[model samples]
Target: MRIYGPSGTTIGSPAGNTKRSGSTGFSLPDDAASTQATRPAAAPKAAANIDALLALQGIEEDPVERRKRSVQRGKGALDVLDDLKLGLLAGNFDASTVGRLREAAANLKASSGDPGLDAVLSEIELRVEVELAKAGQF
Candidate 1:
């Protein structure tokens, strides 16, 4: 089998040895200098604006990470509920556990951007509210 290359070309020819067929030169139009002269200089950015922009960038949270955090919070709330149950069964219930449950309920209010997880979290929040209401601590 034979492999063919362009006419007037050889397999081992150096790129520098290639023949030029056009001017290959670049030139700007006559109005290029006038356009550049007419353009306005960029204004300097304020320090306060730069600081605010940086702070806003830091404030943006990743969706997946936010979802994971929500799930963990839901699990934490569930664990607290289980503890509450065990405490009741053992006659060792305390006020701190209810306070933690209230905090968890508040944390569960933030959306996790996942439909299923948000639904589950809402259910957990509902249960927490119910427990808090029953204890008259809500």
Candidate 2:
């Protein structure tokens, strides 16, 4: 009677020599881009939106990370301010634009450690809040 166990050259193995077969390469196409292009673009955009939403919540507050995020928020708020101001000048302060400005203000609450920049950010945030409130009353 023979008991079957590991056949490879491992500890307590019965045989020291093992026979292995050569692995054949898969018959995949060389042009990966062609295959990838067939996928629906909407799937990637939805995944990107989810990733962005996650990134926005509970962001790391390490000094370097905070500075990077703070700069992003400041720049984003400024861009929103520019757009909002331009739209206000053009008499286009619809609810959508007001909502976007409010969102920017909310995200721009972090201080960047610079007195001058902090003051400017505070002013921009205050203006956005005031503008949104005034728009809401109308």
Candidate 3:
């Protein structure tokens, strides 16, 4: 994965099977040297400009607010899923209804993207749907 400079020297991660040499790597190519010489030295000025942009926008880091937002999103998803499960269980269950319920449960599991939770929810929903169908609830 490591890319190398033109001089056969490692510049980035070692190419397939190579390892990093602490802090420094092999030499640069002659072309690389010429390129470096011609390159404008504007890194410090760019960094100052970035800092000014941040200050002008009055941006500040807030880890607590970020965590709160994440928690709220998680709770909202959970609430929607809970409501779906409850509705599925309470609905009449004919063969066609059961099939639809199974499809919905599978879709829910797929969209949630968590295999463990998907499995548990799928089991609970499928068992209830099957029982209701057998009892002629539909």
The C-alpha RMSD of each candidate to the native structure, in angstroms, is: 14.8, 13.3, 20.5
**Best by lDDT, which number?**
1
Off by over 4 Å in 2: 1-64
On TM-score, who's better, 1 or 3? 1
TM for every model, in the order presented, reads 0.57, 0.48, 0.26
At residue 105, candidate 3 shows an lDDT of 39
Q: Which ten residues in a row have the lowest lDDT in candidate 1?
A: 1-10
Tell me, by TM-score, which candidate is best: 1
> Tens digits of per-residue lDDT for model 3 on 15-67?
55334467676645455555655656565544557768866553453545544
lDDT, residue 42, model 1: 86
lDDT (CA) for every model shown?
Answer: 0.82, 0.69, 0.50
Q: Candidate 2, TM-score vs. the true structure?
A: 0.48
lDDT (tens digit, per residue) of candidate 1 on 1-138: 212244654566444423345786544445554667665888987577787886686479788888889989999999999999998999987899999999999989989989999999999999999999987842
